[model samples]
Target: MSSSSPHLWSPVRWAENGSVRLAFDQLTEQRDGEPLLLATGLGVNRLWVPDGLCRMLAAQGFAVARYDQRDGGESTHLPPTTTRNPITALFAKRGEAYTAEDMADDAAAVMDALEWHSAHLLGISLGGAVAQRVALRHPDRVRTLTSMAAVPGDATGLRTMRYIRLRTLAKFARLKFPDTPEGAVAAGIAASRLLASPNRPLDEQAVREAAERNVDSGVHDQQAQSRQIGAQWHGPPISAIARPTLVLHGEDDPLIKPGAGKAIASRVRGARLVLLPGVGHELPERAWHAVTTEIREHATSAHHPPAPPAR
Candidate 1:
């Protein structure tokens, strides 16, 4: 497969899910590869998923599509509410915007728009939690589940705090950037650097390019991040996910602890867990091969199960 141009993606498509409209785009044109839908984290848009990573997956025979969640990217941004900070929102008693179910439905809406009846789900950070919820609410629509750098879907309020690093959160809360487009790019680069593994060098050029692609990267939109973090899940927990599941966590992740991956793997029956060393919250180029390989193998195994031994 040839390397795909970062700017040469399918035109942005709209998926209408109830009151919200989601923005998404197809990164690959492979009809034979398994359909893979990516859900990004927090306030970041679909561009946050590195183009190189998507290209690598496409080369591995996966048709990839990524989308912006309700309050992020080009998606419908709801009227601003009282929630102003992600930390406060995490502890809020109730969601001031939408429920977690609505967010999961957004993923299904994207899949519907792509004409895919079912697809492998790959989500990172907040996206990871959303993916877990999608599998629980719409099991038939998810062929397999992959959650990376994410907490458990059902964990909420104080319970969710156990897997987070408060110091890292503090640092994120301290991040301040101007509201201009240039500031948005700076904020994105800074945030990416913060999430990058300390042991490896981050490719600032890739981050700058991605940020430049979306001037309104949403990294500074604390309100939207708050609403996303505050959205509560009332549906079944990760324990109820019946689809083949894979949990990946960075051992050196500064934002979310590796235990989050363990929790998801432990709850989901027969789920596989892979902890990557020298990896932080972000998917650097160094870790792309491992991540793609794992996802490819996971999807293939789910499709071709081992033959049962003769009795």
Candidate 2:
């Protein structure tokens, strides 16, 4: 229950319909007597949330937990690469692929495994997609929902061709480089360069530190990340969500454009959208206060007590 550092709560092996055993890294901490579950984005392990966010949320008296998605971090990898096109893999055909619904089911399964009937859900990027699906499909399992830097399955709201080309290039670079230290360094630089705001002073040490942490977290299967992305891209629409939702996006996001967030807000009735200027794709320290504040406020507001008799 301590907030000083991440504590290994337990390991969960969730069996899906196909008997696929998905592994997850579950970190739990108590805050304000409520439990908060964080589902991370693609290509990242449980460490996707920065330490500052962990401490801040824990300080707010909510128990926080984060897990690695299937095919990423320490979870089970799919198989050796066969497809050369990342975009094609992301938009896979029917029965032969996984979808965001599967990922959302995985999250719900994790919560059920932990015996939590409901928990606040927070997701970033691809993780946000899963969270949305979860809230939509299993509204009773989510007390509150927050999607950061995410889209609502609207391909038109994505970045321009130039940015897509840049991301494709980065994907190729990652495929070529894999998990080498040099590749990690290069990937970190590329991510920072692509996601950082020009007005804000860049912190080289922090970037390097983040890179090191990503590397040291252990090797990830590139194929799994690819598959997860593919599934999310072809997942269900976001119009089914009924949970009180909050969508946070940077006004200057270079990767997933702000239009995506706006689209999501428009689809989900009563979903609040908070757009911060000068922020980028990655969750920088400067935007931490606002991001966490909004999440806490939204979640707290949604946690309503039983209504008294009509008067």
Predicted structure with the largest TM-score when compared to the true one: 1
lDDT of 2 by residue, 60-143 (tens): 766776766776655655654554344555444531346666777888777775668899988887788778888877889999
Model 1 Cα shift for residue 194 (angstroms): 1.2
Error of 1 at 241 (Å): 0.6
Off by over 4 Å in 2: 1-18, 21-28, 95-97, 153-175, 216-222, 232-236, 305-311
List the candidates' TM-scores in order.
Answer: 0.95, 0.82
Which structure among the candidates has the greatest lDDT?
1
Candidate 2, pairs of clashing residues: 31-61, 31-62, 31-63, 32-61, 32-62, 90-230
Give the C-alpha lDDT of model 1.
0.89
User: For model 1, what is the alpha-carbon lDDT of residue 177?
Assistant: 86
